[model samples]
Target: MQILIVGGGTGGTILGNSLARRLANEIRAGKVRITLLSASDKHMYQPGLLYVAFGQMTPDQLYRDEASLLESSIDFHVDPVTEFHLDRNEVKTGSGKTYAYDLLVIATGARIVPQEVPGMAEGSENFYTEEGALRLHKRLMEFRGGTVAMVVSLPHKCPVAPIEAMFLLHDFFKARNIRDKVKLQYNYPVNHVHATANVARWAKPEFDKAGIEYETLFNVREVDPVKKIVYSEEGTECKYDLLIAIPPHRGMEMVETNNLGLGGWIPTDRFKLTMNDHDNVYVIGDATNIPVSKTGSAAHFEAEVASDNIVSVIKTGVPVREYDGRVYCFIEAGFDRATHNAFDYINLPELKPPTKSVHWFKVAYNQMYWSTVRGLL
Candidate 1:
């Protein structure tokens, strides 16, 4: 059997590692060929990017080279995916290469299109991009005073990323002794702080303590750079001197190019992540608009499910493990305080609190990211 894993992201890398390990004998016997495809060589620990912009973590602290991250048993392809040829059960790369698969996994995470936001193309820095991250870092250093709004545009990758940026910005201001001069606001269209009402309730006290303003249920129609105002869906407006906007994120052009928009995603079963329309196709992570936080942890959980099912398909032509829609996320509140959030696919963040030692765990929590990379490569 031949297996193709597309998009070497958090999901792809982990899935590649898990499957190869599980099918080592088959791989050695030449019964299966496992290939990992990635568009870039750099593997970024994206959750750390928020801390990196504020100088909490350096660029070096959040990286893993792709070639070194995947296991040697896996064949790695450094190429771009031009489109998916679903009819032939193959994926074509930019270099005119194709991989025919007995099973294919799609882990193409979302991409930020700041250009999708009106007035953003006027050249405001976006934190989601590499250049944008560095530009925003420099801008924050020069910001001595005035309102700073960390607003998220519609349908973003990490729904809580803007809020994290708000708290991180607060820490930056406090470090510079200008916390009093700067006003931080997290403006979002979502009705809850998180998917769970419990976490939202816990988050309010943190907001009050940080003095970070929270605006809910406000959709940002546009970014007015000339006037520095963010208008709400209700016609109300708020002004800001510096704006940190997380713009809309979308699936690859290939999805629309290939007629695979089942509810805005390539249709797949919730747990198995297998394409309902095709037996050879599978999907995980942000590629599907799965009812969960579009965070790395969710990808990890999906990888476990996808790998087991893929292995099962290889042997029996059917998936074994079912996805429970489980996700665990780490939300850092300012200054040595952090919380772990676990929510089911039902849009409810669990009410049970994790250990208070969770703060100390962050120091150790980082190694898991590296360990996962080392094990995969």
Candidate 2:
């Protein structure tokens, strides 16, 4: 079977690497052909942006060459995809080349739309853009210290990032010996935390210890840059010396453009990553509207299920594997401390405080990311 995958971001590249390695035998026997399509020369470690904002990690450490890692057995197209002809099972890239396939995977991850919130992308300050990151970095360094407010706009990528910002910013200013110069605040739509209580258990205590004031159920409406203020829909106004916001996250345009996924996402069966819309199409990662935290761990888990199902389909057209919707996130609270939580199980597990052990796990996860790229995972 000819398999063509699109968008070499987190979902695509990792899936391509795994699929190519697992199907090496099929490729050698001329039973399968795999290819990856990308628009850029570099692949970014998006999760690392949290560290980048605090000046903890640099831009150079976050990017890697896409072609170097995708095996030679798999064709890599470093061109932007203009359209996906789902009807014909073909993809048209920016270079005007069309490749047909028997099985297709849509791993094109979601891209955040700061502009969706009216004044957000107009450049007051945001963490969802490269320009925004540099601007926020400057805002952090130039801080003489006053009210530093970090607000999560709504549902966004790596949900823990905004909270991480709150704590890390506190640590940042503390390192400068100017911690008392400003009051730190965290504002989000969650009732002071996240959708799950496991995070809140540790987060609340940390906030208390750090002396950071937090606002939950607060929906930000606009940023008045000139006045150094944020206005909310509930008639609440927050004055800030510096504003760092988690912009709105959105799905890829391709999913809607091709009419392949749910409203704007791929609806997959809970067990297997098979598309409910079509038997031949499988979608994973944040692009799919799975009931799980849209994190790297979820993507890796989806890949495992999708790969098994694909092999089963090739054998007797039987679908195999099911998703547990298992997703976990390690929240970095700065000062060599971090914590993570796992949800979606029938039974609740007790969460240990975000501790030193969390720190070591996070350090090793960087190598895990590289290993996935090298197809070792």
Candidate 3:
């Protein structure tokens, strides 16, 4: 059996490594093959980009050679697929090479499109990319005092990032002894400060205590760079010294070009993690249009479930278990304190108060992420 996993990000890497380990004997006996294809040779720990923006981490620390994190038994390629021939169980790559698979996994992930919003790309700074994070860090260093506003668009990855950015900004200014001089503003599109109800309940009080001013129901309409003002669809506007935006996101262009799903998000079975109407094709991470937070933790959980089911099906002629929409995310309250939320489809997440110990754990996890991609965690 040939298993092809596309996109070497969190989901594909974990699933590939897990399958390589579990199917070692089968592979050695020439019964199973696992191949992973990715666009880049470097695998980034994406959550660390926030730290980069804060100057807590450098861009070099956020990356690892993609091959170094994978199992030796797994075949890894840096060629990105340009065309998906799902009907023939084949994919054509950028190098004009075609590969066929018995079982396919698509984890192509999402891309941030600040261009979708008018004037946003020109006016706001974002930390979603390495260059953007470095630029934001430089801007933060040059900032003396003024209002630092955070603007968010819907359906972005890591829903808690903007909230975390606000807390970090508060702490950052406080550390610089300019807390009184710098004003922090958080603007969200939704009516609540956070899309998640429990999270909003917990973070709202913290924001109030930290003196972080926020305005909800403020969907970004356009950014006036010359006037340094951001206009919302609701007719409200905010003038700022520095604008940080969590821009809109969409799944990969390849997914859209292939007509796999609307907006490049694959129609996936919420529990089984399979592409809708296609049992042999699985979708994970941001590629799936599942009602879950698009975070690495969600991808990790889904990969585990998918790999387990794949291994079970190959060995026992039947699949075992289902993804329960489990997601475990650590919320960084500030530079030195953190909390976490763990929930599944049937359960609502109950967030604990932030603690320094959890913060330390999150810090340690940054380095331990290598082992995680290797399927050791």
Predicted structure with the largest TM-score when compared to the true one? 3
Residue-by-residue lDDT tens digits, candidate 1, 310-371:
78877887767788898887766655656777767665675434344775577566657867
Winner by TM-score between candidate 3 and candidate 2: 3
Clash totals for all candidate models: 6, 2, 0
Q: Assess candidate 1 and give its TM-score to the true structure.
A: 0.93
* Worst lDDT 10-window in candidate 1: 347-356
- What's the lDDT for all of these models? 0.77, 0.76, 0.95
What TM-score do all the candidates reach, one by one?
Answer: 0.93, 0.93, 0.99
Q: Is candidate 2 or candidate 3 better by lDDT?
A: 3
> Which is the leading candidate under lDDT?
3
Clashes of 2: 2
What local lDDT does model 1 show for residue 117?
Answer: 66
- Estimate the TM-score for candidate 2: 0.93
lDDT accuracy of residue 167 in candidate 1: 66
